[model samples]
Target: MDGDRRIAAEIIEAVGGKENIVSAAHCATRLRIMVKDKEQIDQSKVEHIEKVKGAFFNSGQYQVILGTGTVNKIYEEVIKLGVESSSKGEQTKEAAKSGSVFQRAIRSFGDVFVPIIPALVATGLFMGVRGLVMQEKILSLFGITPDHVPDNFILFTQVLTDTAFIFLPALVAWSTFRVFGGSPIIGLVLGLMLVSPSLPNAWEVAGGQAEVIKFFGFIPVVGYQGSVLPAFIAGIVGAKLEQQIRKRVPDTFDLIVTPFLTLLVMIFLALFIIGPIFHSVEEVMLHATVAVLEWPFGISGFIIGFLNQMIVITGVHHVFNLLEIQLLEKFGNNPYNAIVTCSVAAQGGAALAVGLKTKSKKLKALALPSSLSALLGITEPAIFGVNLRYFKPFVMGLIGGGVGGFFASIFGLKGTGMAITVIPGTLLYLNGQIVLYLLVNLIAIAVAFILTWLFGFHDKMLKNQE
Candidate 1:
């Protein structure tokens, strides 16, 4: 406990003391802090702090990398020290107001999907496990024929794997509602209605197995299974509508009337208006993404891979969630995940070079763990803490990422799931493509490491530190 307090004190002092801080929050592994004065931050001092892995200014926040579990502890201690804590939604809203149009759109997409990624990631892992267990080689090793597998076991896995994607709209809507300050339960119910059993399944309609329902003899509607945009749009409308209704409804009956009217009006709008229009828009976006990936000579892959980490730096990488989800829904696989993994690996590689070349023990300590963390598929530590601090290393990483993405595109490598990458990404390729995936990552890491080692860092900084 004393150690925690001390570390917390160091963080507070490094970020320019308590008065400079507006709000602080924590994600899976970062302590995201929004401070009033960015210039007051001591980047070098923060990075050298004990228990601090890396730190960077992203979007509108000064994000400190404290790694998983440790971040939560430090977050609590910081709060105890009189630094006000803000909800993630509030932080996002503050950050969202300042970016360019495209950037703001990307940030909005991130806001909607960030809260829902845990469910998707859990589902993806479950799918990977199911794939591994169902593989012929695994079955043979277990001396079990395909027909001999237990029926209940298969059913259980199916239930676990399919629940998230099957009802993804509800998850999106629930999250969007919360982000927009609406009642999450109402948002969830509205989302559930979009994919209700009463409506024909979306895939069935897509496959021509079931017909779309014609409402009032003209309105065409179908279940929104695996749809993201519609739920996102509907959530916004529902939240706004709920807010408006609450303003008019008397306090005595506010609870019942607010929910009833919000759902009643929003569901109709979702079914008749938002669903069909955005569904078409989603299709166009999906098709456009496919076209970009299919561009000749791997140009598309090179571009995407090179710019991937740049997007992460701006804190807009979560926008890719929509594209990946749509890709998996339409194609049953996501190549984007494969391509982006290269970018992540390259960042790790660059960080590794920095770790090895730097003479300063403090810089070495920061670089190594950040590199390892990036290799594990989370690159914030490596990016914010090491590579970006030394500008050359980051550019070297982009070059390596581009080269790796080009090769992956040429070879057409893809993963079986979305959301997991780098080391844990191996789970997605367990159905016989693991070697190809590993080779791609190796090439990416090697290229970035060599380029960074040769040209990325200057010894002058190390000399100064010494």
Candidate 2:
């Protein structure tokens, strides 16, 4: 705890002291601070702080990357030090004003999806495990034929693997409500109503085994299992509507009346209106995405790979979680994840080259740790701390990533899930594709390392760091 306080104090001082801070908030991996005077900040000092993996200015905020759990602790400590803090939604709104319309949309999508990735990652791992155990060769090696496997065990695994996607609407709506400053519980209830068992199952309807019910003989409704966009759109509407209603209701009756009315209206809008409209939009998006990914000669994969880490640097890469989830839901696997993993590996490779070639002890220290971290599927340390600073290495990493992405797509390599990548990502390829997965990563790392070592860094750059 004392350590946290010291780090927080250091961070506060480094970012031009608490007096210069306009507002502070944190997301999953960063301490985002809006400062009254950017000129007062010493970026070098902040980057060198203990436990700070990297730091950069983006969208008018100085974002100090502290990875996942550590950022939350540092944020709490900052709050304790008399610095005024904004709610996530308020901070998001403030930050959104600095970006273009497209960038803001990406940031909003990140806000919604970042909170729910853990659930999707867990479900993906569960699916991998289920796949592993159900493999015919594995079953035979264990002397347990597929026919001999327990039905109850299969059912249990199915439940584990299916729950998150099956109830995706609730998760999306709940997170979206939180992002939009609404009552998360009310958002959850509205989302639950969208996928209630009482409604016809979306999959069953698609399979032509079930029919949608007509509400009052005019409004047709169906369950929203596996849907994403509708729940997100409904969450915004619900939150805004609830806020407006709160203004009119007396404080004494506000809590009770606001929730009841919000849910009543939101649920109606979600089921009969938002669900149908966005479901079609989602279908179009899904089709478009598939078409792009399946484009000839892996051109789409190369572009996505090259630019993926750039997206990460901007903190908008979390938006891809929605696409990954949608892909997994529709096709039961994610080729996008496989392609992106190569991009991640390329970043690590470039960072490793920097680490190996740099003569300055400080540059060596930063590059090595950041490279290892990137290899483990986290890239901010490598990108923000080492590669981006060097400029050439970052570009080399992108080129390497593009090359790797091309090969991955050419091979049609895919993981069983979304989220996890690089070394740990091997778990997702456990069902007979592990070897191919490893090969793709090796190709990415090798290409990136060779490129960066040859052209990306110089001793003069390290001297500058000194």
Candidate 3:
């Protein structure tokens, strides 16, 4: 542990010294850093740090993707550094810029969720496969559908897929408490309260019903199931309250009394204050989606272009899951879903174009398949494995995404109800959305390819040997 801290501290210094860091936090396997200037931060040096797997910047955060086993220690060290620096008045104005509302929002989402990417990857793959399985006659013969399938497999998959959402507050509370230097036990207690089964009906308090004897005559705490923001708020309050309790309590009973008091207060707030506030925010976003979709095309186009990328990185990008399910819920199939499909294809196209033009044989090999994979809506390979390494490809892909999103929005292309698949979905077999989906995808690919070819690759000379 000491050695790890020593190494982390050394690397922190080597990357333009501590003064260069505006703020630092970790998400899953990556360290989300904001620095005074990208120019001063030595990306190569940072990448070379012991246990550092790779380094890159995306959407303004300098991400140091660390390997497993060391993320928690590094995250803690980084947070302590942040806290201590602030205390000493060594903090710079650049830190303020790093903590902007937009940047903070992105960072919060990433930090809270990125650490759980492996489980998510598995869940996503499983869900995607399940969708395909239900559609396959051979698999259906084994009974996989709601009516036909064995109950056990369905229950198992449900548990796996729903675990994250059902217990999200618990996870958030734990992570936030760790970051804030509070007790994990207290966090767990607070988090569990938000998702507790009892809180949902607590909203009946607002109705002034008979036998409505509330705690002190009618104030009630609402449930926070499937909520993200409320858990965060509760965690923050819990941490602060824990600190206060720790300061007041004597050292002898510190461990026992501190957590007990902290948990009690946080549960109260989670049930009463934080949960309700977050629910309101979610409602706002849900309601706004419709109004925005109804707006003028040009305005909607720009917003879609901008917000789509934002949504993808946050992993909530799968909230589109609900929309896809909406097809099954209402119409038995979804239509008008071309936007995300095309957006994903744009990235793949951009990567593929650059992959072909790059002089490096190894890079080309990576880019080619990455783009192909991304066309099916898997951008991790394209974004991280390809674009992050090759600058021109990422730029072209961003351009392609913007262009494709704009045009698709203008044409009013709609998706046919189908589970998103990589290769099978590319054909546009069922509807005009699929056809236009292919067209928009092709347009993005062509534009990205042209841009990458003209811009020139960093390793242009290397591939000539092939």
Each candidate structure's TM-score, on Cα atoms with residue i matched to residue i, is 0.91, 0.89, 0.59
Q: Over the stretch 140-166, how does candidate 1's per-residue lDDT look in tens digits? A: 999998899999999998788778889
- lDDT (CA) per prediction: 0.87, 0.88, 0.59
Candidate 1, superposed: residue stretches over 4 Å from native: 1-7, 44-51, 69-105, 147-153, 461-466
Assess candidate 1 and give its lDDT: 0.87
In model 2, the clashing pairs are none
**Model 2 quality (TM-score):** 0.89
Candidate 3: tens digits of C-alpha lDDT, residues 1-466: 5867865785677567777876676554566666667787776566446656456665555676554446667766766654222321122123323555866554444444444444434444454455545454646677554466778878887776556656766777876676555787778777887767665532233344323324555564565545566776777778888999999999999979998888777776666666656657755654565466546664564456435644765534544543343332222232334555555666677777767766756566667766766766667657766565555566676666667666767776544333353344543223323456567667666776677677735564334422
Which segments of candidate 3 are over 4 A away from where they belong? 1-109, 117-121, 136-146, 151-153, 201-220, 290-345, 358-396, 403-443, 450-466
Sorted by TM-score, highest first, which candidate order results? 1, 2, 3
Q: How far off is residue 65 in model 3, in Å?
A: 9.5
lDDT of 2: 0.88
